[model samples]
Target: MKRFHVHVSVENLDKSVQFYSTLFGQAPSVVKADYAKWMLDDPRINFAISRRGETVGVDHLGLQVDSEEELLDLRSRLEVADIGFRVESQIGCCYARSNKHWTTDPAGVAWETYHTLGSIPTFHAREEKTSTAACCASDSGQAGTFNTRRETTRAKHCC
Candidate 1:
């Protein structure tokens, strides 16, 4: 099975959490000082929010799979599209450890396909100053950097 994922950067975490909780009719499953996540079964979406000093809007969209096989299946589909994507194995981000394939759609909207391996203590293992770390979508949703070499960018922490 797979769950739809949506990550958004917000100006105010508390306010955003309050609004979303009310809208969703439930509190988030995971709450941290700088981030919160709603593992909603009703809609089967991994909706997350963060105050990570990034643009205040939808950051990126993704598909979170349940097993490695499912992830590989998704990756194969991406490869068939030939749009180009980068793979990160056992990477830590969004307070979880995952293996991800990062890419951008035709309009430059960032897309991530991943399988969560486990949970982590921090948002990411460490801060990266380089551009070849993770993918981030700006407010325009088209200012994302895609280093073809690694297919990653650290414009902001990945979901």
Candidate 2:
């Protein structure tokens, strides 16, 4: 099975969470000091919001899968299209670890297809403090930087 994923950066975490909670008619499934996620089964969507000093709007869109086979299927599609994409193996972010691949749509919107492996304590693990340019492969979405964090631009300067 697969779930639609949408990540948005907001101005206020609490306020946004409250608004979304009310709109969704339920509280978030996972709430962090700076982030909140709603794993909605009704629509099968992984909707998440974060307050990381970034612009307030839809950040990136994705498809979250359940198994490696499903992920491979998505990858094959991207390969068939000959659309360049970046693959992050076991990348840790958004309170979970996933094997994700990123590609941009015709309009420059990022589309991340991934299979979640497990949960992690931190939103994203820090390792040797690499530059933001090295995090994601590509996707020149609205503001570039692939929405990794608001402080940084976005998804590592698109492919």
Candidate 3:
């Protein structure tokens, strides 16, 4: 099965983790000094937080596939559609070892397509050295506004 992914950047990891744990009614499954992740089973959400800046909200949103095959399929589909992607390997970010494909929508919000390879020990910013850009790369608009309608519709019908 797939998982709903949300990444938030916060000023304080401990504070945010406390707040989210209270709201979600559980402690994080993975927690580090600068990051925390709750792999919520009840809600099926892969909620994660990164302490990068002073911001207190979403950094990006994405879907987590179960296998490498699914990730490759997605890459192929995006390639066919002429959407570019930035790929990253096992650099420590978001509290795991993941292969990620990053794209943007009409707005500037990032959409991560990822497959988790394994767990990591630290929460460090991922250094992406690749030159490839993903779909809608030039747009500077935020992602939520562009995808809100579709998200709401999916929530109503599919969820």
Quick one: best TM-score, which candidate? Answer: 1
Against the hidden true structure, what lDDT does model 1 obtain?
0.76
Better of 1 and 3 by lDDT: 1
Two-way lDDT contest, 2 vs 3, winner: 2
lDDT per residue, candidate 3, 41-119, as tens digits?
A: 8899898876643345766788888998888887787677766555655534544667666666666566777788776
RMSD of each: 5.8, 5.9, 9.1
Model 2 scores a C-alpha lDDT of 0.71
Tens digits of per-residue lDDT for model 1 on 108-148? 66788889999888777564554333333222222134444
| Residue 109's lDDT in candidate 3 | 63
Q: Which stretches of candidate 1 lie over 4 Å from their true place?
A: 127-154
How many backbone clashes are present in model 1? 1
Assess candidate 3 and give its lDDT: 0.62
- What pairs collide in candidate 2? 139-158, 144-154, 145-153, 145-154, 145-155, 146-154, 146-155
TM-score winner, 1 or 3: 1
